[model samples]
Target: MKPRTILLSLMSYLAVTATAIAAPEYSVDHGSYNFGTVTQGKKVQHSFTIKNNGDATLQIKQLTASCGCTAATPSASSIAPGKSAEIKVVFDSTNFSGKVQKTVAMTTNAGKNPNYTFTMEGIVAEELQATPRQISLGTMKAGVPREVTVTVRNNGSTMHRLISATANSNSLQITPKIPKQNIKPGESGTVELTIASRSEARILSGYLHIVTDNPQKKEITIPIYGSAAK
Candidate 1:
């Protein structure tokens, strides 16, 4: 064959190779998120769906969550023919206040559209306002009921409950009475506590756990430092 003819054939092969190779297709269900309202020092999570729209299987090369406080995970490594997968995103609300929005980036097998981005948004509230974050119970005798008042007020207008209160050990018991377990906005109440140390639980110096909507400041294991009978 002549050299001119060979050169013409080589040019035609290069043109056909470029046109025949197709790019991959990656599809994400949603691109943005809004948590509406979240409490400070709390955790929020959301799941995103991913589907394949191209002619070939979808392989996820890597994923980069928006921030260090955020986490992202997938249900599977690869998507089968005409199938789908899930991506889970979790946001940590700590040292943050008010409105917040974040994003996550994903890389796939596509040539033209190899990456996709998603988002998460929310609002955080301040710690539950109160006179003191801690309380102290003076000295007491065993088998005697000791009561104390925990002055608490909800700073926000939102309806919330103190949820539940507990003791770290069996040496004490807490009963949130008066308003009898419910307190409205700007309302005042007393959590009647009964700290009766067991005959064996002498000389008590333990803690109690208080859970509330205020995650950052929800738990207050105030010191119950005192002495019990022998």
Candidate 2:
């Protein structure tokens, strides 16, 4: 090869390497956070700091949460080189119980690393808890009525009242079997639910909403699933 050609090729390679090195890069202070334990019907939030480690500006294109119960926001849409910004993630525990984990995703203009994700996890404690959480009637013949009982217990420190019980579907009926409307702390009661399908065979699915005096868990849902056979 000619000497002039080799010199030009080396110059081109150096320029490409410099441009690649100057591209924007993203670095997060932490990848995951644990909130430990939270009460139901409350909201929790955490902030994650992100730094731009490269020579170019970092442009955040979008931020998204995993579900409707979660939300995320960034402090700035763009960050200058060597600067940092914050991303806040909030989780609503109104419809969640037990252990839960949620994530927030960020899309940025960083060349090599364009996407980042942060996670938050915790356990939710409810004032009232229902056993089985869900009821499955299996396969049932059409026009036949099936019954199942769910045990409702008060897990809180104070006594609570069973205000009412309702089913979303007209084909299902709910009955509270507890002798007294008010239940002492740590006590339990039963709810009897009857599900029936009329003339047609189809999939039966509905929710049982139970109203209680517990402030945090005022309404509890019990999912019902079954198939009506012809």
Could you say which candidate leads in TM-score? 2
lDDT tens digits by residue: candidate 1, 45-118 = 99999887765678888879878989999888688657888988899887666788888889898767888888
By summed lDDT, which 10 consecutive residues of candidate 2 come out lowest? 170-179
Give all TM-scores, in the order shown.
0.51, 0.68
Please provide, for model 2 over 1-230, each residue's C-alpha lDDT reduced to its tens digit, 9 standing for 90 to 100. Answer: 99999999999999999987888898999879999987677799999999999899999999889999999988998899999999988899988889999998899999898998899999987767788798888887776777778778776677888888878754444444444567777888777766776555477777888888887778878888777776
RMSD of each: 8.7, 5.8
Kindly report which residue stretches of model 1 are placed more than 4 angstroms away from their true locations once superposed: 1-22, 129-215, 218-230
